[model samples]
Target: MGTRKTKAPPPAALGRAGTEKDLPDHFKNYRHVWVFIELERGEVHPVSFELLGEGRRLADQLGVQLAGVVLGPPGDSTRRAVAEAFAYDADLVYLVEKPLLTDYRNESFTKALTDLVNTYKPEILLLGATTLGRDLAGSVATTLLTGLTADCTGLDVDADGSLAATRPTFGGSLLCTIYTLNCRPQMATVRPRVMRMPQRSNKPIGRVIRHDLRMLEDEIVTKVVGFLSDGQSENANLAYADVVVAGGLGLGAADNLQLLKNLAQTIGGDYGCSRPLVQKGWMAADRQIGQTGKTIRPKLYIAAGISGAVQHRVGVEGADLIVAINTDPNAPIFDFANIGVVADAVSFLPALTEVFIRRLAPGNHIRLVN
Candidate 1:
């Protein structure tokens, strides 16, 4: 909620500030990478483990350990989630079991994670870019007075053993790599499926370090009355779908989204729309696909009439293969898409639908590309 503060480089040309405080020597001892494992309504968010998978890579690159920080109610589910983290490749897991953290409120989780970080320092902290994660990450980074990068598309270890956080800038037109130079626990949030989920090891070996929540429930400001799920709707599950058929602004009319649906149904895939479709009320919010929308990593993605701007690019970059249908060859979508068809989406969608329908008819199996 507050503006992220970056430390101004001290006047190195001159002398250090007279009031400059010295950092403790123990600060140098801080090591390893950490992920803030997010749990909502007794379910461990998938993004949390996805981050652990990535954190494991960074930790291995830096030759350090990867730890997951989970804060929630004291129960078997919470413990089970910690063990799952280890199975997913976390070298260590820090658990802050407390009643105040039963539900995801900004204040309680922030306090718990910050306390753990301060007690046992880590060089890097990663979180998911979900609504709850963004809310919690911003507050936690602010509380620790550290640098926080949101919605990073990539994370890597720099030569100096620091986190190289790469994210889209200027509304996703370009990419920028940010560093927390003098800050500890450089924080970042990766959207769901932005990183691959590591294979769960059958060995399942890791240490669980339990921490205490010093703050009482009475001291917390926010309270959770109930948990409302995004389900109970007929919208297709695009995020987890094997195939997704999405239309963009190029679809021309609100009714044109039906063509996308027809193609989706032909292939037994989910149907979705670009941001404009959602804005025009042609589709629901859950069906929108872009940076501000759901991040999808389907096995196959069909983008019709989408210009493929950076905002939309970041959201779908994880797809195994992308097929673009647009009249313009110069469309940015062509750059990243595996297959391109320079045809009007309105005209081509139906043709493709018919082709796929005939191909999947009974025992017919054929591959067609355009």
Candidate 2:
């Protein structure tokens, strides 16, 4: 999500100054909250459901319906996506099916989504901040001439029924809440794993409103010639990993990162680093963890030699168990970590690694503590 040049109001005052009664006559007609279900390559992205979970809450608070908007070619994948949206608690879904939408093209998707918005007039619209979402969201918002808050970490409805979108700003040093006070269908995009997944219920599929794409194939400028997969199987899968072990500048040298790798390997988990390690060229960009990088929700996160800044905090706070190993007793990581160990990470990691190796050795017959 790209930053906006407009100055945002401080968090304390967001949504307090405006009421829906103050909206223009046309804007007042906007009602439900809609999440764009990202269907790509015959599958729906999980972030779409995550947004639906959040949309459910905002809809209930405003006494409005929560809906999912799906754009794709008509088939089992599209059908399954609609059902999954209902399972994720969407009250209804707006589906636009066409051959041109078989693969995502910016021109086709932007037109289909904008047409739906203009016709249905939802009060709030959300999309995942993925590659496709970011591309389409900018066009849709620009065409509608509305305000969009990108990469929002929090979503809420104020007493006045305005959308309160909170995101990190000033280089992740602070968070601010923005309200699209004057626009209809307040737009926001959230990254994957930023919101908790909603519980799925085995409900029969709910209402589905079908719409047509009015444009012809010749009207679109871009064409999907072919798709080549990146095929990087060894690429970091930190976002969905159950266990993550990461290092920071505290390790003192790039070579010491192998200590973290050894520990992660012994425990059967992925390894990563803080943003500084990436800047220092010690780790690849994809392995960086923080607001600018990946947001993780691991079951167990072990951080070594890192001072937890606000940027890094937002990424890993969702971890079920956070263990911090830093030499400084007052490192910011200690504030939220479940366990804090003040020691040289280079030395401590190898010792901890050996203990795990021994405990899990063949015929050890010892169950590790949960």
Candidate 3:
């Protein structure tokens, strides 16, 4: 168990350099939009298909092809990933399978993807903002001397065929669109669940272009020694929960948070809190909700006393129905919440919990939202 090494800040990473010049002749041939299909443990992350859907839209808009770049061990894993990529709208799949790529090692993966990009150039590259994706994307983007926007909320192609990557900026108070005008392959990393998963099709896979893993084992510095799986904990599964009830700083005290938990349990929902509570030791870090926290897409979300700042808003905006309860009428939560209750959450929560508990006990058919 050794401490993981991190990349030191390089000079080029400090500022925008060589970004003004137009695309060179050698780079002008870059075509199509490509997504890095992240494969691990014989399964692909859903974010890969999510990106394929997005890349398909961009490719269609740019009048180019949508391709999935799969880098993994040579076997059924890679083949299955390619077929699934096609079902998810990828017009093509680029497979670079090798023994060294069986498990994710930064050195081998960077070289594999970079080699594919150098030989078969693509106009745009998309990756999920997962731990592995962020690590691989940074190394690949830097190696290619291109710009990459991380955790983009939106991705689109401009009229000129350049990538328009939009993400939250200024402490999540505003969203800004970024463009890699001079870069040959514009790159962006999207957080999971930020974009809706597209409908999978039974259509046949378009084409698979296989490439060789040219690097030797001796050239790689990092290696995956073993894998360790953590046991499941009792924390809320906020990311994919159908119903979530969360509280913010306005709950007044740590003890009062129990009211939210009781309500959430009564309604068969999980409970979480805003980031401030985590800092105050009132809630665990996993229970925090905001841009820096989990991006959730629950069917019903109840926020108690949480003022919806841009950071928190970005995380939970995908909820089908957001019920916000706060004393302040002008709270930012009111701007987007479908239901607003201008009442003291301290009293409101307990009363609502009692009502739901009573209704749930007998043969009463009831809608939980009052």
Candidate 4:
């Protein structure tokens, strides 16, 4: 005789009329928050860890887990990235490894990430605001048809358990906090150094799960041709710089930017320009300082002829101490500036440069040319 199979009992109120024990699908099950771990040239970018730190906080608030998504070529580096993610307080890590992913193309990353999100829904997604990050985030958000907030200055978990992303609006004159409403995964992009770096632990514990892209050569359209990086001599390295001197339209004309450079030379600092200067073609896009431009965290930030617009405020707010020079005493910069000098940038800049040059050895520094 065959062994008798036992039947299991059904749910308690399965056959009851007007039963109230069943919870709605939306309230029953949901996963966790995830960060897109960014790696460049086989190296992990710091911003990825920053996002992980932030994701950890959000996950804690939502009573869920924090996960990191890393895509790269299979090797020790990939494993290392997963381990580091754990150290950054990630509860779980999902990784995709393939040769086609060895280089970052908008197509490969977007496809890999979207596929993962569809399979395992996450409440939030975060990425750094680097050139490559910006490229990928925009495409991914569009592909998923989800609302994305870019250049967010603030992120938090609301009491109702939603991502509150704050960003500058109306040319940085005001701030706006955006909510995704019904979007599955609320997305946002933050600059490289906007958030504080997380502390790493010696014993980081997390689970790692490997994922297969299931994509073939024929599936991928774009090929990695080549990559060009800045030379050591020509690199801006703005975020790491100890001191920076930036000028704005208050300098008056293209010619006046030269004065700003001269001041930077005397102070032994890197030189940069504001958005207006870039708009006027007085400088390249790399030199612009504002919300839409570079987010520099220099030890000392000196601004000349700048009226301190909100957009510009976001860029340089990372400075340890900000010194603003403008003719208008009511300039917005004065509100947050550590020190304020109300004077014409053209005259004040040159005078400040002269004082710095006199204080230092004549030939010890490289003079910034106009």
User: Against the hidden reference, what TM-scores do the models get?
Assistant: 0.88, 0.91, 0.86, 0.83
Residue 211 displacement in candidate 3 (angstroms): 1.5
lDDT of each: 0.83, 0.90, 0.87, 0.82
Tell me the tens digit of each residue's lDDT in model 2 across 2-100. Answer: 555445664544445543237888888999999999999999998998999999999999999999999999799999999999999999999998988
lDDT of 1: 0.83
Worst 10 residues of 1 by lDDT: 13-22
State in Å the error of residue 42, model 2. Answer: 1.9
- Report clashes for each candidate as comma-separated counts: 0, 0, 0, 0
Relative to the true structure, candidate 4 reaches a TM of: 0.83
lDDT by residue for model 4 (135-175), tens: 99889899988878888889999877778998776666777
**Candidate 4 regions with alpha-carbon error over 4 angstroms:** 1-28, 253-259, 262-268, 357-370
By lDDT, rank the candidates, best first. 2, 3, 1, 4
Report lDDT (Cα) of residue 140, candidate 3: 96
Tens-digit lDDT track of model 3 for 114-208: 99999999999999998899999999999999989989999987766678889876547878777787777899999877888899999797889
Q: In candidate 2, residue 2 scores what lDDT? A: 55
Runs in model 2 deviating more than 4 A are: 5-21, 226-232, 361-370
Which candidate would rank higher by lDDT, 1 or 2? 2
Q: Output the better candidate (1/4) by lDDT.
A: 1
Model 3 lDDT on a 0 to 1 scale: 0.87
lDDT of 1 by residue, 1-370 (tens): 3543334434661244334344446567779999888887778888887888898899999999989888889898788788788878888889999888888888888888889989999989899988888898889888988888898888988776778888776556777777776678889998887788777785475788989888988888778787656674574457778899999988998788889889988988897878877888888997888888888999999999999887788789889999999898999999999999999999888899998889888767745332
TM-score of model 1 vs. true structure:
0.88
